[model samples]
Target: MTPSLPDILVGNFLCMAEPPPPESAGEFMAGKVGVVALLSLLAAQEAERGPSARVWENAAIRAVLTDAAEAYGDAFAEAGAGVDTDFTLGALDRANAALRRSLIALHEAVETAGDVVRDHAILRLYGQMADARRLDMPPLPGR
Candidate 1:
């Protein structure tokens, strides 16, 4: 059976952590290994969830723009009508970039119009987006 990427990463981390060399640089090497291990774990998490998060965020942004269309105009509607057909990380990232640009424009328009309700709604979505992308990173050593 093929080992999953996360499992493989963790396995490598374990292997690398053991049998520390009996050299003066052993501690330094351990520190470096710890950092790499932490990074590997984070990458594992991203590999599992990053794509879905982007897709969800894209849909969410589109929904917000669609709702704003009545107040904003056809441009808002057109931007919101975008759908994600490609699931590749690069494609998702590119689409996210485009949608976020539109979101920025929509937010600016709303702010300029003094639409407090819409502005607050966009702000809330921004918070949600940040929360969704958050990783469970471990604290660094020695605070």
Candidate 2:
């Protein structure tokens, strides 16, 4: 059976990290290896979880926009109505990017209007976005 993308990334990370690189390669090379290994690990996580996380974040942001539309404007309602049937990472990311721009505008509008309730909702959504995108970073070696 063919190995998954995450599995391949893990394999690459192992190959780079094992034997700890040559001592002759010095600190710079070791540092480079560490960086590449970290990237590989992060990429693996994204490969497995990125799409779902983005979808959830997008939906949550849209919900906030929809609810705020009455106080803000119909533009927010229209923005919230957007759908990403493509579901490809790139497509979803594009839709997400646009929605994020709208979200930012809505945030500014709420703050400017002193709409505490909407502002709090937007702030909560921001926290959720950060949590959704958080990486499962492995602890440094030797504690």
Candidate 3:
């Protein structure tokens, strides 16, 4: 079976990691992986669909994606740094957290939208974001 886009993207991100404490590094890597996957997914969607008329019509969705894009960019920029310091890791974590929050808002807006095409497109993007987040989550202890 073919790997999904999020899986492929996360795999690529994890491949480049140099190894660190499992607890801290796992969370950090997961967050970075999710951000990279989400950004790539968003870009691909926009590229395939072009600028959506619906996105411009709905201020909430537009704002959500705009803010998310910015946060994702910030996180992506910091992703290459060595995770040797708590400061660096924390910065990336905050950025990814912001991005995730914005994405949730975007998904909510899209779900309530009346337009079928716009809803479908946004829903797909939202699903990808969710998948990325789930992929990056730390494993349960003793499970």
- The Cα local distance difference test for each model comes to 0.86, 0.82, 0.47
Error of 3 at 17 (Å): 24
The alpha-carbon lDDT assigned to residue 7 of candidate 2 equals 64
Q: Model 2: residues >4 Å from true position, as ranges? A: 1-24
Rank by lDDT, highest first.
1, 2, 3
Encode model 3's per-residue lDDT on 8-86: one tens digit a residue.
5566567556464667576787776666666566545533432232222223333446544443444322332222223
Candidate of highest TM-score = 2
In model 3, residue pairs whose N, Cα or C atoms come closer than 3 Å (at least 3 residues apart or on different chains), thus clashing, are none
RMSD of model 3 against the true structure: 16.2
Error of 2 at 20 (Å): 15
Candidate 3 — which residues are off by over 4 angstroms? 1-64, 67-87, 126-143
Please state the error at residue 15 of candidate 2 in Å: 14
Candidate 2: tens digits of C-alpha lDDT, residues 19-123: 754663888777767877787787778877889988998888888889988988999999999666887877778788889999999999988999898888888
TM-scores of the models, in the given order? 0.77, 0.79, 0.29
Model 2 lDDT-worst window of ten? 1-10
